[model samples]
Target chain A: MLNIGGLNQGVVIDHIKAGGAMKIYEYLNLEKQDCSVAIIKNAKSSKMGKKDIIKIEGPITVDLDMLGVLDPDLTLDIIEDGKITAKRNPRLPAQVTGIIRCKNPRCITSTEQELPHRFRLTNKEKGLYRCIYCEQAYKR
Target chain B: MKHVISPLDLSMEELDKVLSLAESILQDPEKYSECCHGKKLATLFYEPSTRTRLSFEAAMLNLGGSVLGFSSADSSSAAKGESVADTIRVVSSYADICAMRHPKEGAPYVASIHSGIPVINAGDGGHNHPTQTLTDLFTIKTLKGRLDHLTIGFCGDLKFGRTVHSLINAMVRYPGSRFILISPDELRIPTYLREEVLEAGNIPYQESKVLEDVMPKLDILYMTRVQKERFFNEEDYIRLKDSFILDAAKMQCAGKDMLVLHPLPRVNEIATEVDDDPRAVYFRQAQLGVYVRMALIMTLLGISAG
Candidate 1:
């Protein structure tokens, strides 16, 4: 059994798809933060069979919606006074701005550095986001 | 108010309006001559397209609008490595509307984002050609007198033919529009189109390798060239190059009133002998390209069809 201390006042990101925590970690730039952060990779989970979790030791604003874009299975727990005060499961956003880059080489966003990489949720059932300018579908 | 970057951009209602305007223009060309008189159209073509460029120029001139911009990237600032965004930014200032054709898939879309004026995608690699789709819609509505309840046959190069894909995307919106997609096995329509566009919409469609077998049932026979340039493998190109040729013998099986249309500049895919056939309207289809473009340009410029 792996033992870790509870966060006094911070966020605990849970239920990440196995092996997806590092990407989310890199995306959030959590490594550069001044507070203590621990990443539990390949943690045993009854629901997911295997999952990853991240515990941040101090209160810091994170764009949870971006985590949803990266991995919709992720759940966030806001800890206060050593208690899980708020639990949140981020839904796929309707519109995401300047997060995931359009992968299509021909997409205008590739050449135009000044343009924001904007995508709109086109197919909710399939979790598809299409680039606003190029209309290239990105499946999550 | 709208930039036509793809066929999907136009709603069914908007498509009908453009088609009707095209018909009215076709009937009395003199009435709509001065509709775009004071307007300027910028044709920013990054690739060499004789027919599309000339047709656009003719359409603007016929509507009494002047055209500006280069015929090729070599002649334009694009040769100097100017991005599509910068080119459009500069051109939009001088022109009321711009029509751009590029080798890249979403070049016009990028231009549309940056330009102050409306941007029309003339052709974008294998991705889209909304104006060509508009021309096809106009041709179908004029010849068939209806947009619905028609069995349209798409023959040859279904996989890479952007015109075929665009036309199918537009026509499937109309009620009772069935598609008979005929192509060689190697050149069959892409699975995305089959599953997403046809199957997802619940639009009835049938695929076959033999064009003759499907000819009698078709109200419209749209032939496309098997573009050698699109194929990376020379052997595959040679094998499928003459797969679905539209000769007079093939036309014998087609309906007398069945309209045969092609986005022109044909090679050997369509035999020259078939050109004399009354059903052969590919030339007229090319001519309708002008009217459709005129309608599109006027509509994009907010000029009422008076």
Candidate 2:
């Protein structure tokens, strides 16, 4: 068993479903940023069938709201000086500016490449967003 | 007020106001010229309903407004990962008003929340097509001389026919109007509609499998496409499709003054031979789309469409 050394400062996104770790990485844009990140896939977990954990060493800005979109069940633990300090289940944003594509095949956003496909937060209580052009809703 | 998101949101007075304005525009086309001059109407169609989109653009142009926007999400930044709220916020800044057609159930309702300008829903998935309802209302009022006390038969794909649903919703408001629903057993009107709308309204209605049998009793026959897609079996489609097609032979059984209505893009649902009939009102119905939308735009903008 390989043990991850205590991080001086960073976040550990744990209990992510094993296969869904890549999605989490893409959601956080982890590959593009300057940080030491380790993605451990197929780790043993009593609570989850097969869990994947993301260890980000050094402070890296992560949009937790988007992370919520990828995996709402993810739990984030911010580590500082090798001790768990802050824990958060970041609420998904009610309105996301640019994330999901409008599924309407005939929406203006479908034809005009220059135009932005917009959606509004409809039921924030349920983390729902609807397309501005087509009226499609997404629950995060 | 910048959009026609749903029919129920429009009060009877508001609906009548638009209809009356449409009548004025029809009476004097030139009087309404430049109603949207130097402005633009953006049609953001996320689905393929060329007929509806063209009607909207034509309405805007006839009122002296230019048109912009795309017909699908695939051709826009939406494919590149933009959101609907951002799209409308940006489009609203550019266009005076927008007509949107989407494949989702409540897309326009979502758009209207963040949109600065009016956002009319051309069609939203299988949910609603309110503008078509307005057009139907306008046509019935114009041709039949009244929307009240008429026997309107909604024939064919009532299950998925947004137009039929919307028209039925609009007509149920008036007194003395009854519905004769004609469709195959497989494609009957949905139960929620029957329960929540028809039965709740306590409107008199009859259901039958034959069109000709009910023809003589109808003041208006609204025909909808019998979608081949709705059937799971080829045999069932072949069995029920011909039952709904409105043919010249069927017209002989109809009243002399009875109007035949269709939300256009007809696919042999009404035989071409029947188009020559004076009572065939589908083309007239299609033309009314412009007038009704003209009225709708001006009403939403608080301008006199006339």
Candidate 3:
């Protein structure tokens, strides 16, 4: 049995798709954070079959919008005084700014270095996002 | 603070107002000659397009407004790596209104974000060219006498013709408007347009390769150039080039009142002989283009004629 230590006061991001923990970690800039982060990859689950999990031992504010684009299935739990405080299900933002880069070479955002890469959620069902300026569909 | 980044920027009612102003300008150019006496229009062209640039300058000149700004990126600070935001912020102080054309898609949109004055997108790469669409809408409403209830045929390169997509977008807003798209198999309208714009709007349409077959049914035959660069093979271009050409013979297949419209700089898609036809309104469309632009400038600047 693989055992992990419990968090005292922090966040437990659970139900992440298997192999997605590292991405969440990098996106959150966990390496720069002064908090302890534990990544559990490919953990067995009856619901998702295998999922990745991240436990942080300090206050952290994940960009819920970015998290939504990364993994909608993932659940977030906040702990305070060693007890679960709040649970969060990050939802996809209507307008996404400066997260995923628009890939169209003809897009103005491509040539302008300082322009924020902004996208609007066109289809929530398909998880479709389109560049606000160029109208180029954001492809995963 | 309004910016016309795309054709969809103007509502149908707003389109009517602009077109009405265009017709009035054409009726009596004197009434609106000095409407914008104190205003200035900045023509910011990031690419070389003498036609569009001259049209904008002419429009400003007609409105009694002085014009300024560079015609090419090399002449502008853009070549020196100045951002669109910074340029627009600076240009806003220099001019009351600005018409911009850029090779990059959505460049004007970026400018719109930073602009203190109204920003008109002249042409943005292969993206939005709202003014051209406005000009087209004006031509149709003036010549055809109505904005709706007509069968419009889009012939030639429907695939790469952003105008066709834009027109379809504009027309679908009107009632009882249907389309017949005539293009070669290799140059069909984009699938997203077919499904999203057409099907989503419940717009009735037909696709055909034979222009002759669709000509008689059309009230408006909108033609576009089929650039050789759009085709992958030389043989295909050679085979398809002559097929899409609008000649006197093809005009016989069309109705006497079937107005033909083409965004100009024609390269043999339209035979020179068809220029004599009263129905061939492309030159008139060009004239209307300037008038429409004058109206657009007036609308943007809020310069109503006294």
Candidate 4:
């Protein structure tokens, strides 16, 4: 079994749905950061059956609002002096801009390359999003 | 800075105000002829829509207001690669208000954000056409006499018809606006609308494959065209074709007072034989579009008839 070191002072993005760490890593642009990052995929979990975890070395600041859009069940644990300090469950945002592209063919964002693709949370319980331009549903 | 991007943009009160103003304008056109004399209306159409463009122009002219702006993207700087935001910002300074029709959905929304003047969504792709909705409501109020406690039967292509969806959304807010959706199985109203809108709102509705089955139950029969490609099988198309077309025979099933409407440039969804029926009001509906649009422009421009 391959092993990775625990974070001394950073964040442990826990309970990410299995196979979702890489997407979060890419979304956060972790490769561009100076700090070290370790991804644990298919980690044993009683609750999720299997979950992916991200342990970041050293303190890092990234807006977690977008992560809610990816996986609403995502949990964030802040590490300080090698001890867990705070935990957060980032929920879906009311409005998200430029994170997801509007794929509707008739959407203005499709032709207007400069327009920021904006979405509004029309149904929170269903985690449904609609394009501000076309009201087309966001498809995963 | 107000923009009418969707019918939902107007509150119930505001909608009543606009409809009331339209009724008044219809009752006495000469009294409100100069309501917008010093104002100007810009028709910024990114696509060619002669009917909607002329209706808007006619509305402004009816108000004694001058009209300007392009009828197509090729005639404007959009051909030179100018953005909607940029064009609207410039046009905003040139006109007091503007009605926009764009092939891309929400182009008017983009323009509205950068515009200094009120923007009316003439039509936006297959997304929204608020003025058409306003006109429908105005027609209902002026001719049928009320907006509530009525049965509206939507026929033909309910799936791709933007007007049907918008009118449903607008009417559902009223006290007893139920729907009798008539379309082929392939072109029924989308699930989200059927489940989320109608079912969720607890608005009573029934779906049927045949138009005549629901004709007698309707107070307003709204019709749209059905493309041939939408059928699942050729034989079913042959069998069910006449069921969707409103002919004199189908009109027989309708009530004597029931009104028939269509967003025109209509193909054969409505038989020309039925056009002479006293209840056939689609052409009059288009004419009311001008009055409704005039009222919309005035309401948005804050130019009261008083």
Candidate 5:
């Protein structure tokens, strides 16, 4: 077992698909964070066989739902007083704004810089998202 | 009170209201002629579509409203590098309502977000054309006497036909509306539509390469042009260009009451000889575009017939 220190108070993002921790790290903009963040890539797990995990030491605000979009099977654990306080599994959000950009070149967001790229989850089972403005489906 | 960005934006009840108002306008044109008196319609067409622009202008004029704005992007401030949001912010102040046709897919959506007045999407790339859908629905109801329980056949260029996609989305909301999709394999309907729309709605549909085979089963045969501009390869366009031509012989297989429709400026997909057929209703469909726009303008402006 690889030993890593437990966080005094922070969040631990677990069960990220192996090798996906770097993307989640970049997506969360952790590089610029003033606090400490440890990224573990391809850690052994009995359930997943191999997985990536991100641990942040200190209170921080992160959109878990976005992490769900990046990796639906991810689990989040909140640490308080060096003990696991809450365990949460992020589910697919019904609506997402400014997270995923509309890829359609003709989408108004491509030209109009002020509009936020918004999408609505039209099908949960298929993981389908449609642009709010153009209704163009996001290719999975 | 809302801008029409897609056919799905309007609920079935709201669609019925628009169609009912259109029917009333058809029966008593004079009663609604001056309903929009002293109002203004700004037509901000970023692309050249003579028929769509003219229909909107004529519709507003018939309702006693004045028309303003340019015919193409080169003539408008868009050519001066003004963004759609900024242009619409300025235009909405001058006009009571706005109708925009842009080559970019969601340009009208951006305009609607920034404008104060109701924005109507005349057409937008291969993405959406809500007014055309309204025109089609109005024509369907007018000719078939109902919008439900009809076997609608869509032929040619289903892959890029925004009108066909919008119409199918609208029709599936009604019960007993089956679709007969006829097109070359290269031009079949997109997979998202097949899955999200037909399959999700559990709407019964059949795909076929032969148009004549499905003609007899159709209550309405909607033909679309095989748009050359939509093709990436010229050879592919040339290969499938004549895949489904509705000639007089093909029409012989259709029912006497079957209505034939096309979103026009066609390129040989529909034979000229079919125009003389009693079942041909594309011309009447084009004319209905004007009345439907009138109804839409009135409804959007909250104007009621006298």
Candidate 6:
């Protein structure tokens, strides 16, 4: 029953898998920013055995599609004036650019550090993304 | 500019453009040496692929470009916990063009989206081997004098053989060509290939386990190793092992003009007796790889090697 008092307004990513809050924080780069964020871990849930919740103060831009990949089971709720204003369930992007690594060691992307890892969504339900360069598939 | 990611992305005209450029470079090597002057080509190989790396390096050196990149992932930044994206982002700054090899499927596809210059997939886990396909095409064009109406037999490991798959896909677009798949029961070509390439294209094909039985019918005998690693059981490897070997005895059954090609680093699959056979074209296949790559680099970089 960990609860942070309040926040001005922003997004509340709820129903995150337990202990995944820190990953979300790191992924979002919460510490380096000036905006305030409250992360609650090990919160009891009826659907999920245990979950984590994140409350962000201010309308921080987050790539929801990537969040879907990082934690597919997450529920994002935009809060305004202490009330849930909007709900979003963004699907994983059809093509991911500059995120995720190509696991193929033979692919040129594996060596070139300046290139962004790009993949096209080949199978959405399977979470499979194929590399445009190497045709390597990444499932998140 | 240096990397070749996919064959589908390259049109037929583009393929022809590359092939023609490669032809010119093959005809005149000294003229293209300064084409890549003061440029660097990096190859980051996460897998053990000596053939692809050597060809890439040879292509660059022949074009007056310097080559630098790791051949194994254990010696690279991947061991330092860096993602493939980060590595490419860094390397793109160092090299003008890059080639990569990885075990993970579609690794280069991911790299290409992020790559600043160009990313070439040397090979990904059983996914696609475009360069090898290009080399095979170039070899066929050079030796056979045409890309159409030839019957090619793919022997040995067809199940996980990327080169065989790519060649099959690329060749079907032409007229009068057919495939004779020779493999053990366990290493049969996948259904997707049958349904997608052969059936869809309505290309005639036959399946067999005996190489000698079908040798005379084939204009090109493309042999791939039935690798021991591909077998689940040791007994299976031992049992079907001798069936795929291309020795002098087997070559006797093949047509005199029937060229033998292999995407190689062969162990015992191709016997030493066959190497001296004038019909044996595996070494020539390897040599053609550089020319094909030269063609690919020139085409992708939007420059004619002329």
lDDT of 5 by residue, A2-112 (tens): 778999998999998898999889888888877799989899999999999999998677766777766768899989999999999877899888877788987777777
**Rank by TM-score (best first):** 4, 5, 1, 3, 6, 2
Q: What share of the true interface contacts does candidate 3 keep?
A: 0.95
The DockQ-based order of candidates, best leading, equals: 4, 3, 5, 1, 6, 2
DockQ metric, candidate 3: 0.77
True contacts kept of each: 0.55, 0.14, 0.95, 0.91, 0.86, 0.41
Docking quality (DockQ) of candidate 4 = 0.84
* Residue-level lDDT tens digits of model 2 in A62-128: 5666676556667899999989998887577666666666776655466446556666766545556
Q: For each candidate, what TM-score against the reference?
A: 0.89, 0.70, 0.88, 0.93, 0.92, 0.71
| Strongest candidate by TM-score | 4
Choose 4 or 6, whichever is better by DockQ.
4
For model 3, name the residue pairs that clash.
none
Question: Which residue ranges in model 5 land beyond 4 Å of their true spot?
Answer: A1-9, A42-51, A81-83, B228-239
Please tell me which predicted candidate would have the highest DockQ against the true structure: 4
Question: How good is model 3 by TM-score?
Answer: 0.88
Query: In candidate 6 chain A, where is summed lDDT lowest over 10 consecutive residues?
Result: A131-140
Candidate 2: regions farther than 4 A off: A1-140
TM-score of chain B of 5: 0.97
Across B1-306, the per-residue lDDT of candidate 4 in tens digits comes to 578999899999999999999888988999888999989999998899999999999999999999999989999999999999999999988999999999999899998898999999999999999999998998888888899999999998999999999999999989989899999888899999888899999999998987877888999999999878878788878777778899999899999999999998888889999999999999999999999998889888888876
Q: Which of the predicted structures, 1 or 2, would earn the higher lDDT when compared with the native?
A: 1
lDDT of 3 by residue, B196-263 (tens): 88998899999988889889999999999988998989999999888899999999999999999998
**For candidate 5, what is the lDDT?**
0.89
Q: Find the 10 residues in a row with the least total lDDT in model 2 chain B.
A: B297-306
